[model samples]
Target: PSDFSGFTVDGFKDEFEKLVETDSKSIVLDLSKTEFIDSSGIGAIVFLYKRIEKKNHKLMLLNVTGQPYKLMTLLRVDKTIPFVDSI
Candidate 1:
């Protein structure tokens, strides 16, 4: 997923919800190409995280960087969610 801003959050949310309906054991959001993220994007991610947790599935974020990384860190989303620089 790249550029997780307001414009992209809704699409991401819809796709994520559909994925969550499957039997996948885990979900790893690949943010390697993402350069920015806004409050709406953060909200969407949080919503997915909660839904995943309710389904007893694991959720992780990979390759976070730039403004997105800083904002996530500052908001303590990194602390609450699993995050890694790479796989």
Candidate 2:
């Protein structure tokens, strides 16, 4: 849940799936240290969002910036999730 420096689609997909099962109503993914993202990463993020919403929970993102941020913006994910700058 840190840098995701060597992120793979399967790894993120599995981890995010587990996160949505938590009792907490919200989850935050810290992406401040992440510098880039691929299509697989984007899909994993969207999967997290939908999973949390389906369970009436919130999926939050913090400290997400740089190229990853730009890609999210382009994909309109920023509009769907609340993100803070380096929180």
Candidate 3:
């Protein structure tokens, strides 16, 4: 979604749950189109990251830019969550 805020966080969480059930080794969230994000969104991402980490997997944020990128950087989320320009 373009807006990864509270309004969309629930959906993200639901998706995360589905991802948890999968056997995939790596998970990448493509945020190229997401222009806005709030604390709830950030929190969800962090939670997803930790969960994936616990599974000894990986969670990568892709194409993070604009305001969302700034907010993530400000919160130092970029340090904890890997951000990639491509796959």
- Per-residue error for 27 in candidate 1, Å, reads 0.5
Error of 1 at 10 (Å): 1.6
Model 3 ranges with Cα > 4 A deviation? none
Using TM-score as the measure, which candidate wins? 3
RMSD of each: 1.2, 2.5, 0.8
For lDDT, candidate 1 versus 3, the one ahead is: 3
lDDT by residue (tens digit), candidate 1, 1-87 = 567888878776668878679788888889889988999988988888899899999889998889998999999999888897766
lDDT of 2 at 78: 87
* Residue-by-residue lDDT tens digits, candidate 3, 46-72: 988888888898899999999999999
- Residue 63's lDDT within candidate 1 is 87
Count of backbone clashes, every candidate in sequence: 0, 0, 0
Residue 50 displacement (Å), model 1: 0.1
Arrange candidates by TM-score, descending.
Answer: 3, 1, 2
Clash list (residue pairs), candidate 1? none
- lDDT per model, in order? 0.86, 0.78, 0.91
Best-fitting candidate, measured by lDDT? 3
Better lDDT candidate (1, 2): 1
Evaluate residue 27 in candidate 3 and report its C-alpha lDDT on the 0 to 100 scale. 93
